[model samples]
Target: MDIRFDGKVAIVTGAARGIGYVCAEMLVESGAKVAIVDILADTLAEAVETLGKKGTVKGYQLDLTKVEDIAPTVSKIREEMGEIDVLIQVAGILAGNPAEKITVAEWDKVMNVNSRSVFFMMQAVTGQSMIPRKSGSIVNFASIAGIRGMKEPLCSAHYSASKGAVVQLTQQGAVEWAKHDIRVNAVAPGGVLTNAMKSAPPEMLKNAIEPIPLKRLSKPEDIAAGVCFLASDVAANMITGQTLIIDGGGAVVGV
Candidate 1:
């Protein structure tokens, strides 16, 4: 498809590395002025250096889990950038501690960063820009774990619960904003090879692969391609409050 995002502006969070990086790269390549946000200053700078030469790409090193740090940054971007045409929320973490063994700190850390921060970011940006313009696309990253129970405990229960909240958050945001023409959707990846998944246990890997018809883990670029489609108007116009599960047909089979 000749999907070109010319004259558009995009903001990708947690873009220092992993899937977020490729999402930013693809958007820039398709002619969008992309701004990458992450807490890791060093990696964010490296990403900027690599992508800056391509288009109007810039980097913001801010803690997404903290609400106070994001507002000024968004305002500054507004002054500098024309408008935020697309918002891709890729900032999250996953750590596994068995349900019975999970700590309060662990649960808070997962929920605070994964679900709470994402909601705040959406509120900050969409309330300021999207609600005003009445036109924007918000793509959230949810996992198959959120869609269904993991065959093995891959991440802490908090991680899965937080992502489940993300699915609902997308729905609420989409339903509330569709009147204004804003589209809020999510993509649930089954077994994408992200930085966090590099250390998955053998049993976990075996279970994850067993259900997939492809019998393979997806690449970051694979998910990025889906993000691109959701961001673009070609694949959908009236699409909102929906989730596209790219699970290699693993999610469809039931006993």
Candidate 2:
């Protein structure tokens, strides 16, 4: 089936590279005007330039961890890109440490980036754009680690805990915003070979792939397709507060 987002204004955080970049690209290709946000200004600019060649795309450099700045950033996006029609919260950080070795600072950093920022971003976007318009779609990035905690040397307790929060936040936001015509959902990916994952030690990478029924790491495009589906009104209008797992059957295999 064909999915079209003509005239939609979309904001995709962490759009500088990997999954977020692919999401933004897909939205543009599907006829949406996209504003791509990321902490890396240079990379964000490059992304915008590349995606612009395909369709309308702009870049914003912002530190998502600064939760206080989220509202203002949303304001800026609405001002520059027009009222938001869709928001994909794909900006996240990964930290791995044994529970005993994880320091307070490490835990706080992970939580702030992975969980707290996501909530506030939604608040900002909903308050300034979606809520006022009474219509929008929000797709967040969660992880398989969040659904089921991971063992040592794979995922830190902090990362897992933060993602678990994302799962709950998506549910809460969806329930609270449904009356306003806002849909909140999340995409939980397993072992995607993004730039970060490509940097993993060979042994670590091997261990990650072993449990996947597909026997291969997911590509960024795999997750991007899922995000596009959730963001599409014609495709998922009735779907909300759900975490769609795109793990190559890893979740089914008990990974």
Candidate 3:
């Protein structure tokens, strides 16, 4: 692949496992120093052990949902490791039920973890470093469900709406940050295999896939690869405020 990030530093949130872990591994292998941030305290330590072989890897166990936690965590990384060149947001939550059955607590939890954290984390990272440098990239992990209503809605109204918010948030952030030379883009993925996916019920899974053109689920690496492209200047030089749909062309139908 002609891409090499020999002198860059990256932050991959929710890196304890799944796509976030994969993103961190990919970035480090491509020659960028990476910090793996996750709320899973024990698992974060294990991720560092595996991902630290290439370049440099730092492990941070922080709950991104805490409004005040992101800034200081980012500050600590910057204080010790110089500036971050890339920030990949992969933390997310999904709880699906009929809208009528979805409780307020469920809705709030999904929005706060999946959508709200992205906003604050972006503010902290860009606020403290990227914006001023006028050169950095932010890759958000939005979902295909964000672009359109799920063909088979497994999640309640809130999950889809929260992802939709991420899509617009990416656009807004991109537009506002472009002048700072920072790029913000999102990878809206189709059904990807992850720890989270295993929790879905058979009926919910069936509904989620019937409309996908590919007729098959997406791989975590598939989504991670797209995220890496967006984070790298080589692939997304002129791209910003755009949501790259990696959905097996599902959006072609109605999305």
Candidate 3, residues 1-255: lDDT per residue as tens digits?
566677998999988899899888888888899988899998999989888766699998888778788899999999877898999999887666877888888888889988999999999999999988889999998887777666445546888888999999999999999999999999988778677787878786776678878886778888888888889898789999999998777778763
lDDT of 2 by residue, 1-255 (tens): 788889999999999998899899889999999999899989988998899999989888899888778888888888888999999999998887888899999999989999999999999899988998899999999999899978666768999999999999999999999999999999999889988889979998998888888899999999999999998888999999999999989989788
Looking at candidate 3, the ten consecutive residues that score lowest on lDDT are: 147-156
Clashes of each: 0, 0, 0
Q: Give the higher-TM-score candidate: 2 or 3.
A: 2
Where is model 1 more than 4 Å wrong at Cα?
Answer: 195-207
Q: Which candidate is the best by TM-score?
A: 2
Candidate 2: deviation at residue 12, Å?
0.4
Q: After superposition, how far is residue 103 of candidate 1 from its true place, in Å?
A: 1.3
The number of clashing residue pairs in model 3 is 0
Ranking by TM-score: 2, 1, 3
Residue 255 lDDT in candidate 1? 5
Q: TM-score of model 3 relative to the true fold?
A: 0.92
- Report, for every candidate in turn, its global Cα lDDT versus the true structure: 0.85, 0.91, 0.86
Minimum summed lDDT over a 10-residue window in model 1 is located at 147-156
The parts of candidate 3 lying over 4 Å away from their true place are 151-153, 195-211
TM-score of 1: 0.94
